[model samples]
Target: MAASVGRGAPAAGPEAGGALWAEVWALLPGTEEGLTLALSGEVDDCVRPLLRRARGLLYGAEGRPGEEAAAAALRRLGDVLRDYSWEKLNAGPWREISKAWRQVYTYGCLFGALAEVAAGRPLAPAVRLCDMGLLMGASVLDNVLARLVRVLQQHLPREQRRGAAGLAAESVRTEPRPAPAVRPEDALPRLRCPSLEHFRDNYLIPQKPVVLEGIMDHWPCMRKWSVDYFCQVAGCRTVPVELGTRYTDEEWSQKLMTVGDFISQYIVNENSMGYLAQHQLFDQIPELKEDISIPDYCCLGEGEEEHITINAWFGPEGTISPLHQDPQQNFLAQVFGRKYIRLYSPQDSENLYPHESQILHNTSQVDVEDPDLVKFPNFRKAAFQSCILMPGQVLFIPVKYWHYVRSLDVSFSVSFWWS
Candidate 1:
């Protein structure tokens, strides 16, 4: 991902130079957080000395060295911070470990960003450095790197960015998925951008699922999001890709890789199943967030737009989400390709055979499409509604409703969850 700055870009100009020598130079000092923030044990011990060394670099104390000296020292500290956090990520619980480590990663990005600017590096690699911090850190350096990313992207030559997914999208084999062995009793009702009152009265109050049409045609994402677009916009940024048949499998695991690497190995070659599921990618890559607008229907819930949770679901055909239920209302909007979804009411919870484990209690143990009927006989009695959600459509899933999803084509869907 950290390919050379000259890899795919043209010559840099004066405006880019100002971003380097002026705005970015001013922002770097603010990232000197190690001196103020206190961590426990060996981690604190690691950060303290880095701060002491970097103090003179950012603070401009008496006899502080030139920009080259600052760049050299900061780059070394950045490398150590990144490696320290990386070791912790592989050693402990993801959620708990990522907390303090992300703060460490933030400093790494800060140091890396300052180093890139001081050295007058080209825009492409510099943009990737900013992206690493944005994607992997907590408490980002006051959105400074995000702003830098936007500025650098503007200067990148437009000719290199692909308008559509191109050959990668074209290469998807259109193998039709066979019919579900446990078919739905009925199809979910389809509506064309119904009014708030109508949707609330008919579906929301009753907590029923519905397939929505005419709502997503206006979203720029429908036309703009594709493999090539991601390759251009976020090719160098790392993302967590889920591997194996499904999450329920004993073999399931996650690996971090660049977006370009994920596309090449999974989306194009189809050698492995790598799903980038349930990620807040919009916050990480703000440029991509501009393509889609939140639906008016989300306003029906409290906090309206602010309360909504956005997640990106991108993977090749055959990725499966075993039966599960969420606690909030969801609008699953298909930006491209198709997905087969089936839903069961909360009243059928007993029949759905939810896992007994405390962590997986919301998820059903039974596979909806290929049920082991002899082992779970009650699953046969579970009534369900189904849909093959298409592009330019959104599926409304009520809270606590058991649902399963499978990709029918190379797919990209943005899900919005609200209480």
Candidate 2:
């Protein structure tokens, strides 16, 4: 019977939908037997009657036959599952059983619709089941059912298939573009442990970007902070992660995840860029706070010495901070890896094309690396300094100095902001 049913069904095409149905059959118990066992008395008592009623509705054997019955059955099943507190059940932890029950309900509803479609019923019934499944948080089920629906659509005529294909294409999403690259015209000066007065006089006073080397040598983080060390120390702590390669992109968003998952997904593997930028990580994980000290250059600013705000910037290679300026003096210390930085002096703000919007006033609209000369012709005149900040080095960026930063490798940077 199973072989005959399989042979009678139309091919689902070469794409994911065909394979998805195969996986659905494998994951859902009793589905391979054409749901005969589930519809009969062979399965457990709790779900057996529901499955029977669902099958009856799909096959037009119950209540006002066709799509209406299928829709009603789906709603009833959804309501039953929603109100049945699985957590209170005698089964193990709800989390442990949630996946299995979700799979069961999803496959039960979808397979009923599939049976109807195979019997020459309309495809709208199946689509409704899948859509309602999604609304019920049956993501795994909805994903498979959606693929199955596409596979079924292959049986439709060319015009109908085109419309279905258009709808499916509209549902698919695209990944965001990678961060912009850096192209520096002039190089930044490199200083080796300059005296406080020299740093204040040359770089701080002039509002220039300079790489101050050998400043982070005393910090324990330079030696002890590694992927494994972070996992052991701060793995469980929850932190906000910036999702895209650049925050300036429209698709960019933030999510909260454990530090361990962030490292494994973004650092150890090149899945997607995740950044812990501009976060007060030290305040949350005080143990990590003990590894580093504030740089002396921060004192050169006019603000009170104790009031300086420290932010941690940690991310994998290709993460970018678009050309933007902060209101306070910044001493960015590179602790783990190298980074490419470009800075435009405050005097050249007119050439930088700062965004007109109030919130983005500090950010430049022109892509510094690939400036659209036709639109922003004056951008060509923007004088900027650039440098590659290495471990144990600090770059003092005076207040309102437009700067763009990109990590060259897996990196961790700490910044001190003072007025």
Among the numbered candidates, top lDDT falls to: 1
Clashing pairs in 2: none
lDDT on C-alpha atoms for all candidate structures: 0.73, 0.64
Tell me which residue pairs clash in candidate 1.
Answer: none
lDDT of residue 132 for candidate 2: 37
Model 1's number of clashes is: 0
Candidate 1 lDDT over residue span 1-419, tens digit each: 21111111111334424544555554433443433544333465657667555544555431334445555666677788877787776686676774667767766776666556555665556666676777776664466667766665665555323222334644566556664443454888899989999999999888889999998898888778877778777665566789876888889999877676777788887778889875557887887789988888887887757778999999988899999999999999999878889999999999998999998899899988789999999999988889888889999999998899999888899999998
Ten-residue region with minimum lDDT total, candidate 2: 1-10
Q: What's model 1's TM-score?
A: 0.82
Candidate 1: global Cα-lDDT? 0.73
The runs of at least 3 residues in candidate 1 whose Cα sits more than 4 Å from the true structure, single-residue gaps closed, are 1-23, 26-49, 52-55, 62-66, 83-101, 120-129, 152-185
- Over 1-419, each residue of candidate 2 has an lDDT whose tens digit, in order, gives 11111222322333212543344344333333354522211324576556555544433445443443444454465445433423323267545555445555554546554544433445545544543343232434325555554444444354332331222322222233343343554777788999999987887777777888888898999898865566655554456789999887899998866565677677766667889874456655566778989887777667786688989998878888989999988889988777888889889999988889997888999887778999999989988878878778888888889999888777889998897
